[model samples]
Target: MTRVLVIEDDPIIGEMLTLYLTEEQFIVQRVESAREGKFALGTFNPDILLLDLMLPDASGTELCSQFRQLTAIPIIVISMKTAVADRIQAISAGADDFLVKPFSMQELKVRMKAVLRRVTTPKPVAVQHTQADSASMPESQLGLSLDLERRTIVLDGDHIETTFSEYEIMKLFFQHPGRVFSREELINAVRGIDSFINDRAIDVHVTNLRRKLEKNPKEPQFIKTVWGVGYKFIK
Candidate 1:
């Protein structure tokens, strides 16, 4: 069974999550605060974490940074912080995904699975492509005006910081522009995450990524959606 650690302070919410994850056959470990959350890391060896942004003592952002130092376990922020900046900040602070509160229990489970897919997927060493091939290869770095080698996003020729996974996903899309890719295909190619379109996990990541790279997210010309299909990176 997969192990999950839920770092939530609210007893009621924590219990609800525990019950649901339990039914899903995940070994659930519930912690009330950042302190206990740290302790459970050693004992439970959680594959994924459902972290609350607000704690009784310390901030979830702080905890996320600290937890990252100890392990690379996927951290999904379950918070009431619904602002765009807040969500971006949480992701910057090391959250794999930010889930707003008042979300359904069913939604939480699907998100958890998506996070787990990315977290548990095996990382195989990749061969470096040839320089000549690289010359022909158009990377997302160029589409986003980012420097793939330097790992920097350039907006109007200015650098914009992005998470590792975000960069990887962008690179994949940039390499194959105009190709329609299912969420599962995108996840596997980029971060090895599972497709959970019903829960809109891919949409959230794409939105976050667009806001970082696009000058006007409302009118995104690069990333387009296929109603019954999936997402694709277009010109």
Candidate 2:
């Protein structure tokens, strides 16, 4: 059975999570304080961690950073802080995903499963070395073209510098247009399962990619947002 460690302060929410996760056949260990959570980490080997951002003893972001330094265990932050900055900070601190208050049990379960799947699934192989390896490659899309051999992108005949992260992300996007990948999925797909890169970095890479590839970054055409979800490439 998969083990889950939940470090949340609210009794009502803690009890609610325990009940729901138990129903889903997960072996859950709940702690109400950050201190106890730290202790549990030393003693219990959990498959995943369900952490709250606010605790009586310590800041959840600090705790998350500390925990990440110790292990790569998947962490799904459950917090009441709904601000965009809060979400970005949580990811920067090393959380695998974030869920705000009043979230449904079904959504929590889905997120938990997604994090675990990313943790367990084998890392995908890198993109092909050149376009020759895969025919029918998109030569130009909305003025953005890729030179696989040169590992560079050209926009309207001018080469646009791209970092390895940006290159990989755009490559993935170009390979499968119209597929809506969640942030977690994009992190896993681009950086591999074992990479320690903060999930927030994906946003930075996408922003840079847009500035380079899109005619107008403010009003992008090739890469579009899926609202609350991640971005997708559109042909």
lDDT of each: 0.69, 0.73
lDDT of 1 by residue, 77-190 (tens): 888877877766666566676778888887777766766654432121223444575466656434445465555555434455554456556767877889998877765664
User: How much is the lDDT of residue 151 in candidate 1?
Assistant: 56
TM-score of each: 0.56, 0.56
Top lDDT prediction, candidate number: 2
Tens digits of per-residue lDDT for model 2 on 59-78? 85777777655555677788
Candidate 2 Cα lDDT to native: 0.73
> On a 0 to 100 scale, what is the lDDT of residue 164 in model 1?
44
Write down the lDDT that model 1 would get.
0.69
Q: For residue 137, what is the lDDT in candidate 2?
A: 42
Which residue pairs clash in candidate 2? Answer: none
